[model samples]
Target: MVLYAPLLFLLVLVGVQFALWALAQLGVQYAANHALQTTRVSGGTAAAGRADAAAVLDQVAGQVVVDPRVSVTRNPDTATVAVAGRVPAVVPFLRLQVTTEVSAPTERFRALTLSLTSPSPAGEGDPR
Candidate 1:
């Protein structure tokens, strides 16, 4: 039993590490998506996107993600957000990093003008 015990333990550790990495990846993706959504809306800014990404990371991957970094970029046509972080090492000397990026088209709002003045009767306005 002793010969097989170490192998079993190592397998279990690897599985756990993989699970943690997966969780971190999911969290990072979620953060990026949220940030992208925030920045893609009308009047949204890069700062707002970064803040939203940070908030989501804190809520979703606070424990698993180490040294989390968030970046947001906005242009006239598109908005993008990227989230990156290292996962806490579960096994000895095993380190993993997770990253995700999301982007969407920026919303554009057009101003509409309404004229309140009532038009005169079509036939009465002209002398026939």
Candidate 2:
């Protein structure tokens, strides 16, 4: 029984270490998916699109467990978003970092832009 106790404890420790690493990867995946959603909404624009994308990243950064170590970068031209962060492990001297990137097709808003340029904006002349 005495020998089994030490072996059991070691197994528990290893399990905990793996759990921490998994948690880190999950966090990164969550952030990456969120950032991708923002990029899709922003469409293909230089300023507004990037602004929206950044806002999404900021939201993820603020809410994730590893916010302090989180970093997000978005490339509008390529429609790609990357998220990276590290989660501190419960075990001393152990930590894990995870990163993920997603790319989406560009969305052109030329039709919307041109419509907005019309002399009379929508709902300006009609109440219905």
Candidate 3:
């Protein structure tokens, strides 16, 4: 019974560690997505994206993620955000880092112009 019990305990610890890792990964991904969305919108900035990511991490995964690093970039055409952090160690010897990146085109507003003249009949417009 002793041998079997230790084996069972180890298995349970491993499972719990895996769950923690998964949770951390998911949290980082969510933060990255939110940051990307914030930065991709019109008039958004990279600083705003980083701030948004930090806020999200603090609100959602503060305990699970440790020392999170957020990076954001914005340009004329596209925006990107990345979040990375180490997950709280569940097993004595195993430590894992979770990272996520998201990117999309920046939002822009353009003026649409309407045609001033109506089209002629198909046969009449044709040269033939």
Among all windows of 10 consecutive residues in model 2, the one with the lowest summed lDDT is 63-72
State the lDDT of candidate 1 residue by residue for 29-118, as single tens digits. Answer: 999998899999999999999999999999998898999999899999999898999999879999898998888899998899999999
Q: What is the C-alpha RMSD of each candidate to the true structure, in Å?
A: 6.4, 8.9, 3.2
Per-residue alpha-carbon lDDT of candidate 2 for residues 1-128, written as tens digits (9 for 90 to 100): 99999789878987876776676566556655665555555443334434544455455444334643333344544456565666656556766666777777655455553455557688688778
Taking all chains together, each candidate's TM-score versus the true structure is 0.84, 0.55, 0.90
lDDT of 3 by residue, 1-128 (tens): 98899899989999998999999898999999998999999999999999999999888888999999999999999998989999887778798999988899999999999999999988787798
Measured by TM-score, how close is model 2 to the native structure?
Answer: 0.55
- The runs of at least 3 residues in candidate 1 whose Cα sits more than 4 Å from the true structure, single-residue gaps closed, are 111-128
Q: Count backbone clashes in candidate 3.
A: 0
Backbone clashes (count) for model 1 = 0
lDDT of 3 at 15: 95
Error of 1 at 46 (Å): 0.5
lDDT-better candidate, 2 vs 3? 3
TM-score of 3: 0.90
